[model samples]
Target: MEPIIIDGTAKTPTVKFDSTTGVMEIKGRSIPENSIEFYKPMVDWLDEYAKSSKDQTVVNVQLEYFNTSSSKCILDVFKKLEAINKGGSKVLINWYYEEDDEDMLEAGEDYESIIRVPFKMIEIVE
Candidate 1:
């Protein structure tokens, strides 16, 4: 599958999905006008990748802020990962947050509690 790379904008985060190196990362702020539109292809690609994936899938997410709609999109991403995990593929999620951002850390913990996949919360000391 082709990589998904979107340049970061004021209200939208960058998405980089590199199938070659087995590293998929999403970083930056997220508050897009149309959250579903921005995340549709990404979800589709992930769905496709999950079908034929042999290597472990690692998703790294680092965001400064996101809107409510973006939160839904993120949950969708995790749901996809959960499906992949149930399909017998190894899935790992690393949620990176600033040291003092307890809100983000709590959000990560919430996701970790709900999702069956392996989710790791990482502190990024700035």
Candidate 2:
């Protein structure tokens, strides 16, 4: 599968899905007007990837600040990964947050608890 690349804008985050290694990464701020519009294709791509995916899949989520709508979209993305894990594939999520951002860390923790996939939280100093 080809990579899904979306450049970051003022209101939306950047997305990079590398199908070769099954390392999907999303970064930057997310506050899109229509959350579905920004995440629909991504969700679709993940679904397709899960069907023909490798044994190990890693999703690296590195978002600075995302709105409530984007939060829901992120959860949807995780759900897709959960489905992949249920299919006998090992899945890991690396949620990176800024060192000073407690909210982001807590958000990651929340996702970690809710998701069945193995999740690692990392604090980056920037």
Candidate 3:
């Protein structure tokens, strides 16, 4: 399956979803004007990927910040991945946050609680 690669902009994050390697990445700020619109493709892509997903899927999310709207959309993305995990494939979410950014860490923990999949909270120095 072809990957979904979206360059980050002032209002969005960089998205790199490579099905071949079962590795997906979302980084940068995610405060898009239309959060739902921006994330729909990702959710859709996950839908397609689920059909023939890899044995292990790893998603790396490193966001500096995100708005309330973007937060829900972000959860939607995680929910999709959770489904993939429930389908028997191992799914790991590596959530990266700045060492001093407690809010970001809590945000990741929130998603970890909501989603059934396992999550690794990675603290980035500096």
Candidate 4:
């Protein structure tokens, strides 16, 4: 599978999904006008990747901010990973949040609770 790389804009995040390494990353702000449209391809790619996933897949999410719509899309991505994990592959999520951002930390925690995949809350020192 080809890698999926999308550059970040003021209203979107930078997404890098490396099929070879099984390391997917999403960073920056996500407040796109159409969140579903922005994330559909990503969710589809994850679905495809799940078929030939690595023994251990790591997803790194470092979002500075995201709107409510984007939050649902983000959860969709995690749900895909959860399905992959349930299929016997080891999946790990590294959720990065700024040290002073309580909301971001809580968001990570919420995702950790909702998704079956294991999550590591990484506190970034701004």
TM-score winner: 3
The sequence of per-residue lDDT tens digits that candidate 1 reaches over residues 1-126 is 788999999999999987666578889999987799888888898898787865688889999998889989989988988998888578899999999999999989988998898988999986
Give every collision pair in model 1: none
Give the whole-model CA lDDT for all candidates, comma-separated. Answer: 0.88, 0.91, 0.95, 0.94
For 35-107, candidate 3 gives per-residue lDDT tens digits of 9999999999999999999999999999998999999999999999999999957999999999999999999
Q: After superposition, how far is residue 20 of candidate 2 from its true place, in Å?
A: 1.2
Q: Residue 102 error for model 4, in Å?
A: 0.4
Please report the TM-score between candidate 4 and the true structure.
0.97
Residue-level lDDT of model 4, residues 1-126, one tens digit each, is: 989999999999999999899999999999987899999998999999989899999999999999999999999999999999988579999999999999999999988888888999999996
For residues 23-58, write the lDDT of model 2, one tens digit per residue: 889999999877988999899999889878888998
**Candidate 4: lDDT of 36?**
100
Using TM-score as the measure, what is the rank order of every candidate, best first? Answer: 3, 4, 2, 1
How many clashes (backbone N, Cα, C below 3 Å) per candidate? 0, 0, 0, 0
In candidate 1, which residue ranges exceed 4 Å CA deviation?
none
Best by lDDT: 3
Pairs that collide in candidate 3 are none
